[model samples]
Target: GESVGLHLPTLSVQEGDNSIINCAYSNSASDYFIWYKQESGKGPQFIIDIRSNMDKRQGQRVTVLLNKTVKHLSLQIAATQPGDSAVYFCAENSREGAQKLVFGQGTRLTINP
Candidate 1:
């Protein structure tokens, strides 16, 4: 299924701690996936992306894991910070026309002092 709208949940973590955000996608044929971080009043910023052919990919202080068997994806952030607090979202590249990114429900990450 394609996601036209999203309802994000909330996740709270302490500073200096690691935070893990999980997302589920309905399209098994989606070959590409991306993780984005959206700050207040700003657009979504790209963090990392993984292809369906791969199981894992890593970037600066960030990691993305894809599980095709279960249709699950996760992003791992190292050392949570106040600036890292934002709404995280996962998007799946559509296989149909235009190949637009279909975003899943996001997760709000809150860092406590």
Candidate 2:
């Protein structure tokens, strides 16, 4: 079990709109950052990732932005749909051997019709 310290309990959004999920990381040394979308009971699925050296990265309808100076991370979903509704969170990894991902508090995204 990964630790996503308490944060926002949930979020609601209308269908066919953009969604933004914010996260805060405790480790400033973490070099790798990832955004994952986990369904109700399934495993987390990777959406996008960015490294400490990078400020932003895009994939499909998702974009990940990392602010190392402020230790902040955010995921932006474009034209979100009903299927996009899920628990979205951010993860950080150490650059050292045996990289293990540490998860942050997740924000549940609900798409309202």
Candidate 3:
């Protein structure tokens, strides 16, 4: 039970501040890890990815750190802006089942004025 029950649907953020979006998963045997950003009514876009062998990976303005020891992952966005507002998701491939990605409860990232 790694799901967050705080505010479902979405989250509100400022127009120019860093935003940290979180995701909780259910499985415990997932290996591959990936982060995706999706805009309003659009498909997800790959931002960054890291295999189970690694612990952390960084992109242009984004960073993904994984904690296999805790089965948790997070995304850090630098220089937050309205353009960076989107639904961020952390997905992992199934360990032994279908091997498809089982997405966690997504946190809707909102940017304020």
Best by lDDT: 1
lDDT (Cα, 0-100) at 107 in candidate 1: 92
How do all models score by TM-score? 0.90, 0.90, 0.80
What RMSD, rounded to one decimal, does every model reach?
2.3, 2.5, 3.1
Quote the lDDT for 81 in model 3: 81
Against the true structure, candidate 1 reaches a TM-score of 0.90
Ten contiguous residues with the weakest lDDT in model 2:
1-10
List the global CA lDDT of all models. Answer: 0.87, 0.84, 0.73
Worst 10 residues of 1 by lDDT: 1-10
Residue-level lDDT tens digits of model 3 in 33-111: 7788888889999899878788888889788887777677878788788888778777888565565776665778888
Clashes of 2: 0
Order of all candidates by lDDT, from best down to worst? 1, 2, 3
lDDT of 2 at 108: 94
Relative to the unseen true structure, what is the C-alpha lDDT of residue 9 in candidate 2, on a scale of 0 to 100? Answer: 59
Task: List model 1 lDDT by residue over 55-105, tens digit each.
Answer: 999999999998889888899999988999999999999565675898877
lDDT of 2 by residue, 25-108 (tens): 777778888888999989999888898999999899988888778788888899989999999878888768886888876889
